[model samples]
Target: MNDQYELLDSGNGKKLERYGDIILDRPCAQAVWAPRNPGLWETATASFDRVGGLNWEGRSKVSKAWNVEIAGVVMKLSATDFGHIGVFPETRSLWQWIRSALREQAQTKGRELKFLNLFAYSGGATLAAAQAGAQCCHLDASKGMVEWARENAKLNGLQDAPIRWIVDDVIKFLRREVKRGNRYDGILLDPPSFGRGKKGELYKIEDQLMTTLDLVHEVLSEDPAFVLLTSHTPGFSPIVLGNLLRQYHQSGTFECGEMLLTGKPGVNELPNGNWACWINTFS
Candidate 1:
């Protein structure tokens, strides 16, 4: 799948995006210390000035929903107060990768695959799995994100969908599911750089990811589909993620790869802020 990350222009700590007419003016820390160019900044439909809560400057009332063609898939996009596009186009590979992995796993195992997506922000992966006929569980820590996912599902006319939506910390939820004997054929995880649990529980990816992976393996069935982990932390590399998955692969029998990020025209080099691990059972 073609992950379209078009960097139209950037500068003054702000970036402009033209994703299917819903031009988004977002704050970007990377554009620090300089301006991208002289002209692109002027055409911005909106500029989210970052200070004391982001501010927007635009003429016409912009619609919240729009269709964006990325990697040949027509996924819907929207803006929210949280400053996150849950259905990030850069994640097109993830959606395609999961669906393909599940399909292959099912054919190999001669059985259906149950996919579980933890921290499933916005549900792109969940939607992809559901479309592939995989029983899916979509869990996230943010209720609003779940709602956004639901909207995406509904946009695809997937309302009353079979996918389960759970609002809970991913790690905590997995621990409970393990105790409840709930297992899945596949797992999708995109952990945060840092976060605090709903109950003051601290979560530091550097300190907790491996432990979390150990527990996640307990919830994967013997004949499994795959486990995919992606991170956008500054210091973590694809190798870091690959090595982590390696630690969990007792059999050393898994197909792994690097997540190559891309960008649009004369924009900039690939941003150094993401990593992914896609694991599949060889047998």
Candidate 2:
């Protein structure tokens, strides 16, 4: 992770972070622990105030938009209507894994890889895969997010990369891909706990993820390079995702772990999410 993206302090139902020199304080329900540095929280450049809706407070040096680099890929960040800042720093590990896999495949077999990234916000994983020389299909339900992703791609000099930006519901797209017999070497999806599709289709991960994964299985290549499933929803264990991978194939290596951010001086690791991944080596 870049120094620009750091968890300065986290605790007491909130977290203080630095994004390219701008410090922010935001609500983090997972930070049930006490703060190690209360002074850092008080001096935050801006803080999120979630009253009825959401708003930012305090003196701010940051603009409405900014840029941050991760593994040499530049991403445009912004404080949007949603409480979240545009970029998701927690996904850095997943991006690096995708890049490394592509590089390894190139060295070992010189094979061209294709990836499907669902809910690929701001092109983080999409750019990483493309930067590693893979064709990618980036899917998201939000048109605004897709546009933001395009901007990020351009920022990283990947505007002409082999990336298909699609704005559609994930389940619908996966079903269509199965109908069209479209297959991808790698599949990655970061499902939200609760969300709504373009046409107002509701998605509740707890209720719908298994069915979505079943559909995803239909579109995976016979010799898929990998499948990555990550979630931040409380109570959803990584083992649950590992078990889901069993439905995809008879035998494969599965790994599950927590994706954490190395916090500053006092705090060591701040839990961001949990992940389950499978690697298929046989053709």
Candidate 3:
């Protein structure tokens, strides 16, 4: 739990969160229960919804961009038109896990680890890996996001870290990596339900996730260290992600759980998404 961020309360299709000094009320389709502390929500600085198209009320109260440190990584946050605040707080745990995993592998191998991150929005995982002494390649379809990630790296004083920021389609990038004989010890992906590549290439998760995983396997090192998969799309449960990874590596240690937005005592932990990870014990 980071002091810079907190999930104050959530329910009735919305969530109240505090990032640094700003409190935001945002849509949470999965928060079907009733809010525990309705009084706390009035303190929110801003709120976003999609009733009459995507919009944010009290937008003037929020700065154009702000910073928050979560899981030991500094992230730049902004109220985007798509309702994202540049960082996914639920993934904070994943970043910590990645850092620990890579640190352990680096010690065992006695060398830097090569890590790959797909759909690496804002570069939280990439920074976590870099901080753990891994050479990281962060790829996202949006150039703006790549630039945003770079800024975040600079904010953390990791601008000089061994990181390759690229804006491209995930599948195309992986295919090229495979062709060039580029291999990674660890890989992470957080694909969106629907997205477009830099070149207007459409991506539908249901139709392409298997193909994406296949390409991911091709770029993995012979002694891969780990693979982490997370998603916010409905029905893509932790088991579904575990089953997908199982198709490629059947012997690794598998861990799966729901990604949650949590706060201090008395605040209900909200399930934001799901995650599945496979770690190579023999590596």
For TM-score, the strongest prediction is: 3
Across residues 36-98, which tens digit of lDDT does each residue of candidate 3 receive? 999999999999999989999999999999989988888989998889889998999899999
lDDT of 2 by residue, 1-283 (tens): 4436778888878888888778888887788999888887877888886777788785355687888886567878777656687877777878889999877765665688889999887888999899989989999999999999999999989999999999998999889999999999888999999998878889999888998999888888766788999998887788987888877777778888888766556674678888999887665
TM-score for all predictions?
Answer: 0.84, 0.94, 0.98
lDDT of 1 by residue, 1-283 (tens): 4434465766677666666556567776766646556677676666666588756666235666666656544566655565665566557677887778778778878887899987788888888888777888998877878887887777666666678988887778889989999899889888888876656567789988987898889998877767777787876777777777777676634444444334555675424355556455356
lDDT of 2 at 71: 56
lDDT score for residue 98 of model 3:
95
Top lDDT model: 3
Which one wins by lDDT: 1 or 2? 2
lDDT of 1 at 16: 65
Q: Global lDDT of each model?
A: 0.71, 0.84, 0.93
Lowest summed-lDDT stretch of 10 residues in model 3? 1-10
Which is better, 1 or 3, measured by TM-score?
3
In candidate 1, what residue range of length 10 has the lowest lDDT sum? 252-261
Of 2 and 3, the candidate ranking higher by lDDT: 3
